[model samples]
Target: MADARAANERRVRRLEQMKTNGSAGAASGTLKAFWHGGRKPAHIVVRSALLKRVEGGNILTRLVLPRGVALRFYLLALFEAQCRLAVGGQWENVLPLSGPGSWSDMIASDGAYDGKSGTYMRGTRGGRAAEDLRLRQVQGALRTLEEVGGERPDQALVEVPRGPRGQRLYPSFRLLQESGRGSHQSPDIYTVPTDHWHPSRTVTIPAAFFLNGWVQVLSPSEVATWLALRVLSKWAPEKHQESGVFLYGDARKQQFGLRRDAWEDGCQRLLNFGLIRFARPMKDGDPAVPPTPNSWLMDFDQPEPRERYEPHRYQVIDEGLDQDAVRVCHRELTLRQHALDRRAAEVQSRKNGGPQQDVWPQWDGGEREMRFEEV
Candidate 1:
């Protein structure tokens, strides 16, 4: 354990050095300029089809990165590349004027900034670390996209650029070029005009998500939850708009492959972020009104309500991102996490028979009966 701890400390020190030095160089200025360009696009288009479940299941499940940052970065890059393709850019070629620095900078500027350190955080490390972590994450995402084909040769969504000798190239990258290769290929392939509307095939992520630092403030699960909610809101059935989309069953949750805890936690965070609101009328304490057909309260008076489940009617709030809201959500989540930890500890203590007693019952002759006394 001592050796392991020492090694970890060494690694951290190196990362800190990288962070300090990288920020002081010309590369840093270039990154900032590239990301903060006045002419940069205002919104990013994500292919919803990528989120859809295929035979191999959700692509997110295969991602090596812990947070949703990798997924976000991959989608952003894909959008840019597709736009290029739509405008008659060459397929199966290196992205024009694109390299590791710009790629990593885009993601870091959006998701890796550390408010406390006043520098971009690296990887899953909360404190200072090397900007190369973002590059590695980008590579990992691309690798995952390429390897998602698994045993099926034609299922890969990307074909990473390689040298003539099949050696890996550090800077060059390319999406799958063949017109009809991957069975699970994203609908984002360049075929028609990029500006054409395809409501069912795409989801537009507001530029505010990046510009307002929402990525830095929210967790991976929370980010995924918000995106999933957006997709649902877009596809929700007509007339259900008043109450929002129903997300009650395990089947519904499984569609996105998000575990129950993660999904619930994400929903709670989104609620705290003021990005979403639940519309359960019955739980509002109005006794006169009848519960909706989907409400769990409909069986409230029953002795046993078959199975218990929280009925959710999620409404995605379309509003500008707020810094105050993000700060409040962070504070609320921290407090709630502490409370949950305390409750878990208490339960564990009870299960372990906390504070075993040393006293035992002893007979008292004077009392003429068995009496309890300290042993």
Candidate 2:
């Protein structure tokens, strides 16, 4: 136990040294350059087919649409249909889907009025009409799934939970899994309620899939991130960090080579995604320190600011160059341009007979004799 404690202390000390030294090899060089230069780069924007139409519909509604439709347009249609069925002519009671804050407050509940299979909807134009319309939509969606996938369900009516505050009104359906897939390959569909559109309603179709012999429902963001990363993995940056940086310079002279810079780049990418935050260094000598390099121990599972996911927000620093070199070049250019501008301004002022401010005043550096009496 003592040996283990000593080893842990050594590791903590090493991390502190790396955090202070600011070496190029401290972490991944690619990530170091990215962090030092600027946090914004361009590659991180998510472009799932559903995300493309965020302005026209809420994220939940778009989840129900076919893969290619615009997210926003689908949402608008969903909301309109809900209004027509739930409370025709009562527009004031319906809500409007707006921002991320609204999305977070949404809930899904199973109400007594939750409909069953084969319920045809009828309504005029407001919240009640909207409720019935959404129910029909849910059934329609289920039927379409049958037509496309050709998987028949064992049951006629599956009761799905109503959305937050009583918005959703759809019966769910299930399709049998094909050969070679997991036992629960067929997932039951359910409607997710949201407060985005307010009193009227918006419902989402969610699928519960299996992983590791356990059933799990993937959120929209989770699914998008998985697919996006898969797409991005093919185009990973040319350079990555080597493992040696974590070992400190003790291994620098060793024959084995490690590209520690790559790890830093990964860190920067994660930071750009808002998955991790860079903590301001605390000078106090606390023995129980956090991991300094890569810092993978952070609470990365939490929701990050959506903007960080854009890959383009991180600047790519060429592995061969130093950040100081770029800053020097920029300063030199600015000085030269300022001198030229000053000269041009003086010339322009002379030509136009405009009020001019003298950039340089006459100067006499030599000592002068006391000859004021003669003058």
Candidate 3:
């Protein structure tokens, strides 16, 4: 375990070094200016309508359930590509043409141009296998996106049926329109409407998501979870507090169709990656255990402890990718693990007819002091 941790630390240090060194290059300098101006992180704007549940289900929910992290990434890439092109005017109707090279560039990796083959090749230690797998994933994701909208043409349009009394219906509302089948060589064209009626309702994705070595590390489910939380923050700004955004009830499941286990795992991983933190410790009352043998039991069997339903409040850390932030995240994760272990031990002890152990120590106020250094 210690070795693994050390290796991860070394990897992070290498990424930081690469970022520092690469900033001097002309291309990197250009990207740095366009992405974030070397200060605030660059952000991707996604239309809220894509996440909305129309008559034919939500596009994002469909992508989430199928474990479509790559697809989601592709969607983000499309938006990013469009945003870049929009600067040249024709922001609304123009469809940006993107190929594999454009898509792969969005992710941080070591790659070189193969002059002989006239293709860009990934420069990973895993060799050909890894490169092939990466290409396949990207291509597969593109195909899936095409199929998703292709099967239901009506999904791109909003239209109501004609009334029996000859009443007129409002004009159709178009959300997203796609053209041409995308491929590794020739990419597809996607158009998003920009009009007053269908105003742009967007969610801002932290630029670090693509630039800060996170895209390579975060799993598909983890990415989905992060995006879902961001969407929630935009949808219900009132729920935002200093502690974080409180996620309660079956809203995530009902709205996003994220399974309970998947959601939990995603959140756990995001926490581990230092991209997110729980606003508070999630503690619950112990379940009732079978009573031990007694004469007739004492006067008032302790009133059943009321079940506590503490919703998880999560704060997405946008900046502070320094070592201090990493250490704090590591400490919090360790504490959480210890608490889980203690809870399991207590449960087993009660089942074996042994005395329940004392409650684990709760998180202290010091966690509130957790801070990350802005890059």
- The 0-to-1 C-alpha lDDT of every candidate, in the order given, reads 0.49, 0.26, 0.45
- Among these predictions, the greatest TM-score belongs to 1
Model 3 error, position 178 (Å) = 10
Which of candidates 1 and 3 is the stronger one according to TM-score?
1
Task: Give the range where candidate 1 is weakest over 10 consecutive residues by summed lDDT.
Answer: 366-375
Model 3 lDDT tens row, 174-291: 1133222323332323443332222125566655454443444444556667777776555445433344564333445545555666677677666665667776553344222222
**Candidates 1 and 2 compared by lDDT, better number:** 1
- What lDDT is obtained when candidate 2 is compared to the true structure? 0.26
Give per-residue lDDT, candidate 1, residue 159.
61
For the record, the alpha-carbon RMSD of candidate 3 to the native fold, in angstroms, is: 14.8
lDDT score for residue 270 of model 3: 67
lDDT string, candidate 2, 1-375, tens digits: 234234333323323332333321211332223323442221221212222222222222223332321222222222322323332222221322322111101211111122364222233122344333334444454343333212323221122236678653432222211111122534432222222321112212211011010001122232333222222222222211110011221121121121233223333322332222333332244122112222211122333322121111122222212223222222333333344345567778988998887633331221111111000
Off by over 4 Å in 2: 1-125, 148-172, 175-375
**Ten-residue stretch with the least lDDT total in model 2:** 206-215
What lDDT score goes with residue 82 in model 3?
45
